[model samples]
Structures are given as structure tokens and as C-alpha cells.
Target: MKLYHSTASPYVRKVLMTAWECGLASRIELLPASGTPAAPNRDMAARNPLMKIPTLIRDDGSELYDSIVICEYFDSLAGGTLFPPAGEARWQVLRRHALVDGLLDSALAVRYETVARPEPLRWQEWIDGHSAKIDNALDALEREVDALPAAFQIDQIALVAALGYLDFRFASRPWRPGRPKLERWFARLSERESAKRTVPT
Candidate 1:
């Protein structure tokens, strides 16, 4: 199996963490990718039409894109440890995963606007909107920190990945001011083998 990856991509980090937790990391080879919306890499486009990092090529020559799908695929290959199979537990995990993933999306948008766009072309309103989304999501996560599953599940993985991205790109706008619980949780999670190994370069 091959994984098209980027060290700075939170989405790619999530997939890499999933692979490590699922005990499939050793079976996969990482292929550094330079694909972006503004300038897509031909090699990555051939494997994933969306030209996204964290694209997976399975043993049978099939490809999988999107962090969530790739994580689920890894979970399946590991005999379903990362996700609950059914019922309310499954729903809760999925909901938290979605929320954190949304937060990551907003954070990435803010990053692109502030860092990638030309100074005159950048819109303050768009940046503010995305930052607000990230702030609200962090608040929600802080409030629900106690309720977060004790196990290192997909939800936890996604949340950590989102936080990692914020640290990587939005270091000037610290996220730990009022979210002590979430901050502590992240600190502890960061010590885990997967988190320690996959920290964005």
C-alpha cells in the first residue's frame, strides 16, 4: 500500500495516525505529494482526481481519498478497533469526528487566505469568518472534553490533528487561553506514539 502524504497537512496527519494505531503503518509506504488546488501535481492527480494528500493506494491497485474514508478503511483492515460498530456510540464518534474535521477545514481556509493569497487579494471578512468557526469549535471541544471517549478513537485522533494544524499555522493566535481542559487533553495525547511520531513538521 502507498499513501500520498504531506507533512504539513492535518488531514494527512489524521490518516497517518490512523494507520499507526491500526497497526498498518509498517505495511504502507509514504509518498510525499505536492498537490494543491492552485497548482495540482500530475502524479497525485493520476492517483486521486481531487489531487489531495493522504490518498491511499491499496494492495489491489484501488485508490482511496479523503481522510475519513481512509481512516475507516484502515479501521476495517485492523478488525474495527478505531470506530464503534453500531448504535449511539458510533453516532457520537462520527458526530465528534465531523465537528473536528469541520474545524480543520475552517482553519485551513484561514491559513490559505492569510498565507497563500496575495496581500491585496486577501479578504479580512473571510479570514475573520473562518477564525470564528475555529474559535467556536474549540470552545465546544473544551466544554465536551470530559465527555470525550477515554480510548484513542477516531474522534480523539481528528481533534488532535485539528489542534496540531492550529499550532503549526496559527501559532500567533493561541488556542489554549480559556480552553484548559482541551489544552491538557491535547498535551497528554501529544505524548502518544502516534501523535509524537506524526507531529506536523
Candidate 2:
């Protein structure tokens, strides 16, 4: 398998971390690809119409895009260790995954607004709205932290990936002030080999 990757992309890091957790990292090859929405890499656009990183090209020449899809594919290949197969546990995990993705969506919106947009075009209201979403998500995660599985899971991977991105891009706005549970949870997860291996540069 070949993966289009950007070292600093949290989404790509999520996929790679999933691969590592699934013990399939050695079976994949990473191809460097980096572009922003304003000027996308044509090479990557050809493979994925959305021009997103973490696009997976399987050995059969088929393609898969989006971090969640790629991560689930890797999990399936590893005999479904990362996801709960069925029952209420599955819905709980999926809900957490959605929350994490929503948090990331708001974060990336803030990034593009502040860094990609011209200063004159940047809107403080928009950034603040997204930042509030991030805060709310963090609060939710803190409340749910005690229920997190003992074993590493996909939601845990997603949470770690999102938090790592916040630390990477929004360091000026710290996230650990009142959320000690989440802060400590992130610290503990950071010790995992997959988390260490996929740290964004």
C-alpha cells in the first residue's frame, strides 16, 4: 500500500498511528504530498478529487481517501482490534470518533482562517466560533475520559491526534488549563509508541 502523507498533518498522523497500532506500518510506503486548499498539489488531486492527505492506494490499484476511512480499513485488516465489532460499545466509539472529527474540523477551519487567509479577509468572529467549538469538545472529552477503554482504541487515537494538532498549531491558546483529566490523558497516551512515532513536525 502507498499513502500520500504530510508530516505535519494530524489527519495523516491519525492514519499512520492506526497503521502502527494495527501492526501494518511496515506493509505501507509513504509518499510525501503537501498542499493547501488555495493551491492544491495536482499529483494528489489526481488520486483524490478532494486533494486530501492520507489517501491510501492499495496494492490492487484501488484508492481510499479521508483519514477515518483509511483508519477503519487498516483496523479491519488487523482483525478489527481498533473498533468494537457490535453492540452499544460500537455506537459509543463511533460517537466519540465523530466528536473528535468535529473538533478537528473546527480546528482546521481556524487554521485556514488565520494562516491561509489574508489578514484583511480573516474574521475574528469566525475564529472565535471555531475555538469555542474546540473548547466545548474538550469539555466533553474531559467528562468522558474516565470511561475510556483500558486498551488503546480508535477514539483514543482520534482524540490524541486532535489534541496533538492543537498543541502544534494553537500553542498560544493553551488547552490544558481546567481540563486536567484530558491533559493527563493526553500525556499518558503520548507515551505510547504509536503516538511517539506519529508526532507532527
Candidate 3:
């Protein structure tokens, strides 16, 4: 398998962490790809029209994309351990995963507006809207931190990746100030070998 990856992408980190947890990390060959909205990676675009990082080329000449799909594929390959098979537990995990992914999406949008856009093109209203989304998501996650499982699953992995991205790009905002439980949970997860190895530079 081949993965088009970017170290700074939280979505890529989610896929990488999933691979590690599923014991499929060694099987993947990471191909560095840095793509932006204006300038996409040709190679990644060829495989995935969206030109997104974390695109996977399977050995059988098939392709999978986006972090969630790729992570679910990895889980399936590992005999389905990462996600709950059915019922309310499954919904909860999936819900949390979607929320964290949404948080990261909003964070990335704010990042692009503030850091990628030129000074005159930057829009304070846009940045503020996305920032508000991130703040609300963090508050929601903080409220549910006690319910977060200790096990390595898609929800937990996605949360960690989102938090890592916040630390990487928006450290000035300080996400841990009032979210003690979430902070402590992330602290423990940060010590894991998989998390340590995949920390964005």
C-alpha cells in the first residue's frame, strides 16, 4: 500500500495513527505530498480527484481516500477491532469521530484564512466563525471527556490528532486551560509510541 501523506495534516495523522493501531503501519509506504487548494499534488490528484493527503493506493490497484474511510479500511483489515460493530456504542464512537474531524476541519479553515491568505485577502469574520466552531467543539468534547474510552479506537485517535493539530498550528489559543480531563487524557495518549512517532514536526 502507498499513502500520500503530509506531516502537518491532522487528517493524515489520523490515518497514520489508525494504521499503527491496526498493525498495518509497516505495510504502508508513505509518499510525501504537500498540496494546497490553489496548487494540488498532481500525483495525489491522479489517484484521488480531491487531491487530498492520506490517499491510499492498495496493492490490488484500488484506491481509498479521506481519513475516516482509510481508517475504517485499516480496521477491517485488522479483523475489525477499532470501531464497535453495532448498537449505541458504535453510534457514540462514530459521533465523536465526526465531531473531532469537524473540529479539525474548522481549525484548518481558520489556519488557511489567517496564515495562508495574504494580508489584504484575510477576512476577520471568516476566521472568527471558524474559531467559534472550534471553541464550541472543544467545549463539547470537554463535557464528554470522562466518557472517552481509554482504548485505542477511531474516536480517541481522532481526538488526539485534532488536539495535536491545535497544538501545532494554534498553540496561542491554549485548548487545555479549562479542559482538565481532556488535557489529562491527551497527556496519557501523547506518551504512546504511536503518538510519539507520528507527532507533526
Q: What C-alpha lDDT, on a 0 to 100 scale, does residue 70 get in candidate 3?
A: 94
161-194: candidate 3 lDDT, tens digit per residue: 9999999998898999989988988998999777
User: Can you write out model 1's per-residue Cα lDDT over 11-108, one digit (the tens) per residue?
Assistant: 99999999989988899999888755667777777788888888999999999988999999999988967899899989999999999999998988
Worst 10 residues of 1 by lDDT: 35-44
Q: Which one wins on lDDT?
A: 2
**Model 2 lDDT tens row, 44-63:** 76789998898999999899
TM-score of 1: 0.97
Task: Locate the minimum summed-lDDT window of 10 residues in model 2.
Answer: 37-46
lDDT of each: 0.90, 0.92, 0.89
